[model samples]
Each structure stands twice: as C-alpha cells, then as structure tokens.
Target: MLPYWRLSGFYFCYFALLGGVAPFLSLYFHHLGFSAARIGELVAIPMLMRCFAPVLWGWLGDRSGQRLLIVRLGALLTALTFTGILWRQDYLWLALIMALHSFFWHAVLPQFETITFGHLGEQSARYSRIRLWGSVGFIVTVVVLGLLLDRFSPAIYPQAMLSIMLAIFCCSLLVPPAPVAATRSALPGDGFLRQLWRPGVLVFFFSAGLMQLSHGPYYTFLTLHLEALGYDRVLIGAMWALGVVAEIILFMVMSVILARFSLKQLLIGSFILAALRWLLLGFWADSLVLLALAQVMHAATFGCFHVVAVHFVQRSFAERYQGQGQALYATLSGCGGALGALYSGYSWNALGAGWTFALASVAATLAALLLLRWMPGRAS
Candidate 1:
C-alpha cells in the first residue's frame, strides 16, 4: 500500500511553516522597527541560501540514495537553528538565524520531491492530489495566524513558526524511505549536465526563473502593503488564503487541464495572468474587489505554473539525474527570487509600492515573451 497519508502529512506541516513566514515574517521585522529595505534584505537571506545549497544536497541524495535521511536532518536543523531568532531580534542576529535555518529548510523540499515522486512511480497523475494538501496547509495557517496576530503582537510570530518547524520534524519521521528512481528510457552513458544542457530545457528553466522573479514583490510586501491600506489582519490573512484556495481548486483538476493544454500553453497563460495580477495589485490595491480578483490569479501564477514545471523537470532528466534536475529547478527559482527580493527591498521605499509591483509585471511580461520565442508549443 502507498504511504499516501504520511507523504501528505509532511507536505502539510512543511508548507504550513512557509505559509506562516511569507505573510508575517516581514511584519514581524517591521514590528521590531526594521525598515522595508532591511526587512527585504533579511527576507532574501533564505532565498539566497536556496540558490546555492540545493546543488550539493541534491547530488548527495542522488548518489547515496538516502534522501529521507537528508530530509529528516534538514528539518531538525531548521528548527534548531531557527530558535536563534528568539535570542536577538536585531538585524544582524536575525539575518544569521534566517541564513542558518533556511539553508537546512530549503534543502528539505527538493530531496523530498524526489522521494515523493519515487513513491508514486507510475501513478504520477495523482501527484496533484497529494500536493493539494500543501495548499490546504497554507490556507489553514494563514487564516488562523491571521486571526491570532490580530489579537496578539507580531512578536509572537517566531514561537508560532518554531512550533510549525517542530511539526515538520515530526512529520518527517512519519515518512518512510522509498527506493531510488528507475527509468526505462535513460541512455547508458548520458550525463546529467548533458541532458540539462538541452536547448528546450534551458529555455524552460530560464522562463520559470523569470516567473519567480516576478513574485519577489508579492512575497515580500503584499502583507505589509495590505496592512498599510487599513485592511484588518484577519482580512489580510484571508486574502492570502484566497489565492491558495484557488490554487487548491486548480490542483484538484490539474490532470484534466494538462490533458487539454500543453505545458508551453500553460506556461504562457500563467505568465500573462501573472503580469495582469501584479498590475492590478500595484495600481488598484485599495479597491477590495480588484485586490481580491488579483489574489485569485495565484491559481495560474503559482499553481498551474508549478505543476507544469515539476512535470517538465521529471520528464526532461533521466531517472538518475532526477534529484539534480529538481535541484536545478529550485536553484534557478531561488536565483530569481533572491534578485526579486533584493530589488523590491531597495525599491519599496525609493520606487514606491505601485512602482515595485509594476516592475514585477514587467518581469512576468518578459518571461512570457521569452517563452514564446523559444519554448515550442509541442504538447509535453
């Protein structure tokens, strides 16, 4: 029997931690009197670690066939290192804590992705069903913490996040080991780098990176932006939840959508929707109807885009190179995200919120045009 619940449980706790951090971490820093730029810089630390750590960790998993050990160790270290945040809330101390904790935290997901795919084997279409639990976790945490933070202080955020990290460690314990992946079509001596160097795969990774670059403003500042506009904390959290809610709905029907739309088609649509969503948020943020509508676009921007990318990576590489392929995906996405966070950090104060999001819109548009030029529309 498949260890469905075990895998789902891990994704739940893991994403619940992410859900808490994304909306509240910057707010927590702001509460400590950090400027928007400082908060952005501090937030980018983990993302930067993500850019470099995965290659080493992914290689170890591929060679050793011990991905679960890495996942468990990563979870434990993430929690232990994160406890340093409570020691000092100063900018330097928080930066250290973010880097230490996130180096391990970021390493956990890519290895686990390889493990989860190995477990599924032939039932790959069911991937979305298990992954949707992650979306559910995101909604639950954001909504509950949205309510909690409204009643308390952002100072309480760290302890709450630590608890989720502990839960991730616990969930990691429940997931059993899966065998290393095996593929029928893998060539006898084709190397990982050779497969990754393909022109089509290069365009796909670059285009995906651009989409994540577009996300920098939204991830870093959307909560702060909403709060400044006088929206209550509960409403702000719900707004975040609203996007994931749409994503959950999409994940449920993703197989059907994929059957109808090519990955290239989905990628282009997602990029276009992302551009429009950022523009809506940037120009009309005060308009609740428009804000809510833009939030709903997360289904395409993240949900459909993510499903397509994961599938693309799984298909493009040979079985032995699967871990490295997933790692490369994370690396490119991380590089884009780190750059996005840095630019938004500097721009949030100097360029203003509207302009920062407009920049995001421009990045998404660039991604769409790039993909159109190179990524063939062949159904994948």
Candidate 2:
C-alpha cells in the first residue's frame, strides 16, 4: 500500500527547511557581515554541488535499485555535515559546509521523485496534490520563522535548519521501499542515450536551464533587496510566503489547467510570466501593489513549471532511465542556478539590483523564445 502521508511528510520537512532558507539565508549571511558578493559566492557553492551530485547518486540508485537507502544516507550526511556551520562562520569554512552538505542534499530529491512516481504508477496526475503539501510547508515555515526572526537574531538560523534537517531524516524512516517491480530497470535494448537526443529533449532542458538562471537575482537577493527597500523581516517573510501560497493554490487546480493547456503551452507561459516577474522586481518593486502582483506570478513560474517538468521527464524517458532523466534535469538546473549565482554575485553590486534583475528578465525571455522557435505547436 502507498504511504501517502509518509511521502507528503518527507516533502513537508524538506521544503519547510527550504521555506526558512530560500527567503532568508542570504539575509543570514548578510547579518554575519558578509558582503553581497560574498553571500552570492557562498550560496553558489551548494548549487555547484547540485550540478554533479545528483547524477552520481542517480547512477548508483538506478544500478543498485536501493534508492531508498540513498535517500536515507543523503539525509543523514546532509544534517551531519551542516553541523560544521555551528563551529565556524568564516567564508572559507561556510563555503566548505555548503559544499559538503549540498553534495548530499542534492542527492535526496531526484531519487525520492523517482520513488514517488513509481508508487503513483499511471495515476501521475495526482502528483501536484502531493506536491502542494510542500508549498504549504514552505508557507508555514516562512511565516513562523519570519515572526521569530523579527524578535530574535538571524544567528539562530542554523539551529532552526538543524532541527528541520533532523525532521527530514525522521520522515525518511517512515516510508517503506518502493515495490520491487517499480525500481527494477526496464532499459530498452535500444539504449537510453538515443531516446535523449530524439527531437526537442535537448531544447527543453536548455530552456529550463535559462528559466532557472532567470531566478539568480530573485532567489539570491530578494530578501536583502526588499529589506534595503524598507521592508521589515516579517513583511519580507510574508512576501515570500505569498508566493508559495499562490503556488499551493495552483497545485490544487493543476489538473484542470493541464487539461486545458498542454505542458509545452504551460512551459512557455511560465517563462513569459517569469520574465515579467523579474522586470517588475527590477523596476517597480518599491510599489507594494506591483510587488504583490509579481509575487503571485510564482504560480506559473515555479508551481506550474515544476509540475510540467516532472511530468515531462517521466514521459520523456523509459522506466530504466528514469533516475538518470531526473538527475539530468537536476544537473541542468543546478548548472543554471550556479551560473546565475556567480553572475548575480558579481553584478548585484557593480550593476545594481535593477540591472541585475533586468538581466534575469532577459534570460527568461530568451528561454521563452527558444521554445517558440523549436517547439511551437509540438507537445511537451
């Protein structure tokens, strides 16, 4: 039997930790007296790990058929390695911690995603229903942590993340291994690499990478940017929460949306909206009304794009290649994210926030055009 709540519980803790980190981790580094450029480089370290770690782990998972064990091991090492942060706050040390922990952290999601789809079998449409819980968890943590940070020091951020990391490890213990039939490799004798190069796959991945690259400024600096613009911690947190709340609402109704629009249609729309969202942040973020409206665009940019990407990867690859397919997606996203981080780190101070984000908008718009050029009228 599928342990529905158990799977949901893992996502909850996983993203609840993200909820706290995504909106505020840069702020935490800022509080530690790291410059904007330093923060960007430090944050990019984990993303660099994400670029390669998932593929290595994914290969092991596919070969051994013990993906659950990998999940558990990744969870344990992630938490254990993160404890190094409590011992030192220096840049080199912090960079090492991010790299070590993220090497394992990046290992968890792809394997678990393969496991979740295996359990769902053909009823894959229900994925968003389970994934929305991740959005809820994001909202809960951001709001509650925001309130806490208003009164407390950002220095406590590591402690809070440590607690959540332990919870993720605990959640991993509850779920049984996926059924044997699901994990067994069913590699077609024709070979997986051939399937990968078949029309549109490479283009989809490249476009997806550009979209994540567009997020460089937003993810790396939004909280600090908003704080500099006179928003308080609690309000800043609410802003982040608002985006995920919108994401939750989208996940709730995704099936209807998917029925009406093909995944390629949704992906194109997501890129367009993301471009608009970055431009709004760059030029109009001081206007609370405009900012709020832009935040709501997270539904299309993240919520819809994510659901479609996962579904697309599942459909794109054969069962035996599933783990590697997901790993490739993660790899490209990590590469994009790492590049975004490095670029934003250098540009945020030199070019200023407005121009930095304007560049992000350009990346997203180009991604939208790539799809239109190569994939117009074709199904994702």
Candidate 3:
C-alpha cells in the first residue's frame, strides 16, 4: 500500500504539470500574440518530439535495466529544460524549448508505467484505483489555475507551470524502485520491428493515430475558442476539470469495466464517443450544458481507451519488451496528437471552427470503422 501510494504521488505531480499545459497553454499562446497556426505548431512540436524520445529512452532503460534511474533523469531534465521558456518569448525559441522539454518529459512515463505495473504484480486489475490520483490532480490543478488566471494575467502561466514541473521532479526522488520481473528474459526473439510490422499492430497504430490526429484541433484551440466565445478562464478551466472528473470516476470503476469488456469493444466505444464529442463541441460551443456533457465523454474516449490499450500492450509484449511496447504506444499517440494539432491549427484558420470540428468527427468515425475492421474480436 505504501508503494502504491508513492507511485500515485508521482503520477499526481506529473499530471498536475499536464493539467497546467493542456488546458491553459493555448490561452497563454494567445496572449503571446501567436496566431492559431503558430500556437498549433508550438503545441504540436512537443508532441512530435514525444514520438521518438520515449522509444529511445525506453530502449536504453531496457538495455541498462535501470528503469527508475531513467525515470528520475527524465523528470529532472524535463523540469530544468522547461525553465528555458522563462528566458524567451519568441516563437522559435519557445518551440525549441518545448521540443527539448518534451523529449525528456515524454521518456519519463513509459518507463514509469512499466514500473507501476511491476509494482501491481498480479493485482494489475487494481491499476485504476492507483491511477485515479492522476485524474484528481489534473482536476485540482485545472480548477485552481483557472481561478488564478481569471484573477491575474497570462504572463504568470509559465511560472505556475514551472513550479509544477519542479514539484514533479521532487516527487521523482521519493519513488521507490520496483524489483525487475524475472520473466524479462523469457521474451521471444520475434524482433521489435517485426512485431511492430504485424498487420494487426500496424492497423491499430494507424487507427489510433487518426483518433489522436483528430484531437489536435481541440487541444491547440479549445481554450482560445472558448475565450472567443466570451467564456471566462474560470469557466474554461471548469470545463476541463469537469472532463477529468468524469475520467476519475471512470478510472475508479475501470477494473470492473475491463473484466466485462474486450479491449476492442472499449476502443470502438471510445471512437464512437469521440465522434459524438467533437460534433457536440463543433455545433454547441455556446451551450455550457452541452459542452460540459461533451467533456464528460472523456471518460470513455480517453480513460477507458487508455486503460484497455495499456493492458493490451502488457498482454501482447513480453516483460523484457514492456518498456518498448509502452514506448510504441506513446509514439503513435504523441506523434498522432502532434500531427492532429498542427493540421487543426491550419484548418482552424482556413476552414473555421465548424468545419475543423467536422473534420475531426470524420477522423473519429474513420478510426471506428478501422477498429471494427481490423481489431481482433478477442483481446490480444
């Protein structure tokens, strides 16, 4: 229980940093006078870095058998490098800083996940109970920061974010290392690339990538969109928190859901929810109730999808390749997210909000179709 608490604490701080960045950063970029396209580029660059960074770091962690050290180094370096943002406001400099920070920050999680599951052992079904702390942290941060931004200026955003990162780094110091699983050596010689190239894996990556790509517009422009619609920062923050709160509830019950549903079923359900969610946002941005309800779907769209996907990776890959398997998940999700954000930026400028969101709806639908066609009937 102490170990679980410690692991949960690490996630709490880690996601607190995310809470600041994901929900508020667009508003910050807006205040910085960045065009929508520029803001998208800024947001997407870090995600693009995530596509490759985790894979490299995961590989190294596996080779050295020092997952904890990798996690510590990644967190510390991420915090230190992000401080560079304070020294530069220029888009190019900030973009470079974001890329550097994301390169390190992205590596921290896949290895940490490997460690967390290791700690859970055969009781892995209880992962959601421990992981729910992250959702709680995200909700708390978004609500608090929303109030802060409403009362103050956007200039303080980076400082607030830096403080969270520093806290995350400090928390990394407290996380006890887990024992290496003995089954690490029993992994087959199927080769990483070969496994990655399998038809089902390839289809899964492409479909998941499309799903994330569709979210690019939402992540890069949601706050800005709300602001343009006359919503206050606090309200926007509430919307973000509302979604995560739903996610927390889902996490609390995830073990039961997983027991009843196949991973494919969860994945397909999430895509369908995502389609409806974007459509709601596209057409009903002015309706607080509708928007809030849409946010709640995040429970299905992200939380359930993530849990099932992580479990699938755990079941499919051997213990030795666990880090790499997680890394691959990060790569597709991150890179796809980056691409989605960037493209959304351009489309938002050119196509307008309604059409941009409509496109996202299309992407989500396509992902659902692909999942129906490609995902195996049974959990892999």
RMSD (Å) per prediction? 2.4, 2.3, 2.5
> In model 3, which regions exceed 4 Å deviation?
26-40, 87-92, 150-153, 182-184, 197-199, 224-234, 285-288
> What is the TM-score ranking, best to worst?
2, 1, 3
Whole-model Cα lDDT of every candidate shown, in order: 0.87, 0.86, 0.83
Which residue pairs overlap in candidate 2's backbone? none
lDDT of 3 by residue, 16-54 (tens): 888888767888999999997798678767777888998
The residue-level lDDT of candidate 1 at 369 comes to 88
Tens-digit lDDT track of model 2 for 1-380: 66789989999999998888777788899999999779877876777888899999988887877888999999999999999999999999999999999999998999888888888876678889888988888878887887787799898899999999999999999978777565444455645677678677888889878988989888878988999899997788678878888999999999888878887888999999999999999889999999999999999889999999988888787766778889989999989987887798789889999999999999999988888888647455
Off by over 4 Å in 2: 30-38, 88-90, 180-187, 227-234, 376-380
Which is the winner by lDDT between candidate 2 and candidate 3? 2
lDDT of 2 at 3: 76
Q: What's model 1's lDDT at 201?
A: 86
Give per-residue CA lDDT, model 1, range 170-229, as digits (tens). Answer: 999999887544343468778888887765789888887888899998987898898989
Task: Itemize residue pairs with steric clashes in candidate 1.
Answer: none
Residue 10, candidate 2: alpha-carbon lDDT: 93
State the weakest 10-residue window (summed lDDT) of model 2.
182-191
